[model samples]
Target: MTTTRHPDARPSVSDPTGPPGAGRRVVAELLDLALLALPLTVGALLVDTLADADGGGQTDRVVFGGTAVLIALGILVWNRGHREGHTGASLGKHWTGLITRDRDTGHPVGTRRALLRRGTDVVTTRTAAHDHFTPLPPDTGVAALRRRRLLGLAALTVLLMLVLLASVAVGARPMSFAEVYHALIVNDGAETDIIVHSLRIPRTLLALLVGIALGVAGALIQGHTRNPLADAGLLGINAGAAFLVVLSIYLFGLSTPAQYLWFAFAGALTASVVVFGFASIGGGKSNPLSLALAGAAVAFFLQAMTQTIVLLDQTSLDGYRFWVVGSVAGRGMEVLWQVLPFLLAGTVVALASTPALNVLSLGEDVARSLGTNIVATRVVGIAALTVLTGAATAACGPIAFVGLIVPHIARAVTGPDYRWLVPYAGLLGGVLLVLADVVGRIVVRPGELQVGIVLALIGAPFFIALVRRRKLVSL
Candidate 1:
């Protein structure tokens, strides 16, 4: 039982028992197949859930579907991609104490190599007898990781508060701290009172909600799809919502955000269903690739339809252009109240799903073996994602980048753990959005850029840098 040591990394444990027997390998492969089939089984159930629901249960449907999608995908990626790449073992391999190692250096195979080997090994069972295996690392750094994540969350919360203060204090019309305080507590009906109470407060609150929603939504999207580049829009929520808003303007002469809010929400929820349905078309299973492709196609089609309508109707064109710019400005408490329930529901579901997500990220077989309900967990994930993204998009017209970029920032701090990543992303998102809105107000005094535009301006450069700096991996 000689251990092969690596100076640069963890050493591999040698087994005098030689390689795993053919029966073990066969069982492992079968387990892997079951894991792969889990998604399809869940997708089939999801379709049934959708078909049986009534119109009144639209929100419920969206919530369940989105939540389940994320959980399902998270499990798939963790089991198949991250687990094998980072540790040198898949679920089956872990069970059988099998591992892929460098043929030359006798080192653990990295992600790229692990993935390549997965394909080759499937075709041919032949493995070198010299191959060594290691069990999953113990939960050594968990406490440290939890402590760090908690600290990061606290820091983000504080930053969010500061940004909220800035959002309230600094706007097109600057109010001194005392004046702002007076407006809230005193309410003497002065100019500052009207500005603070009527304008900045609601706008700031809306931004806060939108930020948290987009941020968490982004994190969930990345987790579910296992795509580093995936964002809230990957599910077609934004485009679907925007398209309906425009359509409402064109056909019904709806001019206000409140008027179209429901329509947008409906569109978003509908789009999520459509994406899932399309993904589940073949063999009644929805994979991440199928979901992504379907989402993209649906989003593009909806956008094109929206454009055609906007171009044809002058009234719609005017209303659509402004609404599409994505601003929390001019929206009142009523708008916030309307979307608050969905946001709250989504947030709760998302947070609750994180523990299951953590388990799912380990692998389906492991999760099942540990008593995690694969179907229910995934349904909850997909549902949470739909509600969050739909509410955010409905509240503020498809703000880009917040969902696309905030998760990456959160992931960098929290590592691959979704438990911390989702909350951190939400807090960071609120801070960034409120901060961006404040910057927009100050930079162009007497006028302000919409929050959506500001986010795009900031997000585009930062995203480009993120891409240049690192590889995109779905945590």
Candidate 2:
């Protein structure tokens, strides 16, 4: 934890400076996100628009096939984002006009330190449509950054409101902005008000909340462990959760989403405990790779147990599909609300660890000298990570690549400050997931694909790029 931050820190004022290559990377990231969104968005709208009320066969093909396509596109972008984000934010930083200057030293950002900037940008500057990020004149570098960050934040806020408000206006059924606004303000259910209240508004809010929560959790876990390759399922949380669900179904005969959810959460927590116990073993303690391997081993063992239990009777498989596939469909606002306490508490815990994380990046000896309690931080971080990821996995069935990927992107955008990184990662994750979910809705003509599949498709290439970069760039 050799890193340091300025509480009074402010963005630099300038014309969002960057290296020559930064523009290309920014364009690439934008293109990737857009490409993934485009096909899925169009496909969903197309399928929903064209599908027969009777759910025709042709519509099914279009929706399902499109969903597959959407997944592939999402993967492409996600993979690219990870690569670009992690490789020192190269072209993306330059082009985005965001610079990752060191916080304590007040100089250009070092490799790991860059994540801090991204975190701040993602969280405060990039989240929700707020007027917070007001740009200063370009003559001052810090002022400019602050302004850009603020602008970025404000722009994002407006963009999000517009996108969601627009969706409410024009979804399975369409509404004008005025009409939707009127419904909201009046709080009355006119013919139009019913559609506004029931379908688009709730779903839109749900999307934002889910996306933010998932994205933040993903970032937190990846950064906490410093493993770009790790996913929520890395430690077999899903397998464990699934086993519990299987038990609930075959032995207990409880198949409802609400009933099974608790069992799954319990299983996830149990798996996390086991995984961490193994990781904390040995003389020095487990690093990223060691922890991942341990998780994978635990997951495999649990999955075997689940399979064995299910073999006794075929009745358990029915509950497995819907839970295992990881969907945002058919869930109520209450479920979202129920999981939020865990999410909020976990988020706070994770955010509190940022400063220590920065110091740890400098090497253990340095971090220790700088007054960091490596042991305490690790234990707390793990606990927080376990809860956040486990809750998300248990609630949503192991959404993939997010924890692994979003932090990389966050790192690229901001810098290595965990403070900035956590929020940015979370916001980015939210945006990405919500958008992906939307795409899944339209891609298959009428059928939908799972976000997990889409993230995998997008992330596999990114995983390759990460390996390649780590191979090429040593520390």
Candidate 3:
């Protein structure tokens, strides 16, 4: 007797490649296990080095080592056990062309069934593998997700306001909240008013503007370069600014931030132009890799010139050291006013370019396919980046890590969408720098640490933890 089946019905059983061999299974499992172990081992070694540097005791070592081990185990369980059980393929299995599927239906056994199958395999000393696969569920709720991000941005804004208040209130001569409020709103000409209005207010405002500039510039640079680690420095902004500042000090005897601001701005702008020009030379098309390489070369050359100037002239060295240390202190509102136009222009352009950036993130081929003007997008991005970085560096020196760290933090909350990412980064950058400035004040008491130094101390460990916590977000 012949079996009858409906034309619309599909095959219930399908196995394109049949079961993978025992050798393949064993190799895949070993590969997966090794992959899981590698990060933990690296993290422990790094922690050990840091501990040794800090002169940590045995207990510290034990605690850190144990934490690393536990984190590793958690990852192992997620990657090898839960993720693989749910998805039917670990990294090893995927690499080795193996998958686990139900015997009857030729589909990935749901997580529990897959775990049960593994248990059965262990008991029977047998292997189960197939080539069947299913696509993951489509992403939805984008509107809700965006709304959540908006709320997060608002929360960050509020936090930044508190930090601003703290920056104003927590200086050498600490003032109460009431004093700070009165100083700002009611000018009674008191000592608190003098301190608040004259010193702390200017410094805080400078920090806020500079932080926003650096942060937004950083996000734009990273977006353009497609490098999460990239920042304004990649375009030689810092080096060029330093070079010109040094020159101005050596040649013109300019000693103050205000005196040297124009030189620094010019140098930063020139360096970025040079970078873009060099990147666009051969094919008239600038890619991320080319831009990065060009920027590095220009930066090195400028830095060499800067160092030579500083070494030759004592005055230059002193001035350069002060500028290079990166601080918002000792800057007046006049300095902020000087950079305000460039900063505003850069910010507007940066925001305008966000839509293009989103398209470009899809890679060049795809971007071109979708009618994105790659060169134009890059030019806008670089222009915005240069202007913002130039203005900020000129105003407050190149405050390290504000640019580098803020974008990543913002991205964590805002995802890869540049529209949200840029604004979030700007606000977060302001918050972080101002907060770091406050911490610097408190940590050293009478004499405060530079914002740059504080950022380095805080940023280093935070960055390490960020890396160890999970994979960097894809640019």
Q: What Cα-based lDDT does every candidate model obtain?
A: 0.77, 0.63, 0.80
**Model 3 lDDT per residue over 249-309, tens place:** 9999999999999999999999999999999999989999999999999999999999999
Alpha carbon deviation, residue 154, candidate 3 (Å): 1.7
Report the C-alpha displacement of residue 237, candidate 1, in angstroms: 0.9
Per-residue alpha-carbon lDDT of candidate 2 for residues 177-197, written as tens digits (9 for 90 to 100): 466668788857788788767
Q: How many clashes would you count in candidate 3? A: 0
Model 1: CA > 4 A from native: 1-140, 368-371
* Alpha-carbon TM-score of each model against the true structure: 0.69, 0.67, 0.71
Q: Using alpha carbons, what is the TM-score of model 3?
A: 0.71
Q: Local error of candidate 2 at 144, Å?
A: 5.2
Which residue pairs in candidate 3 collide?
none
Top lDDT hit = 3
Q: Cα lDDT for residue 55, model 3?
A: 40
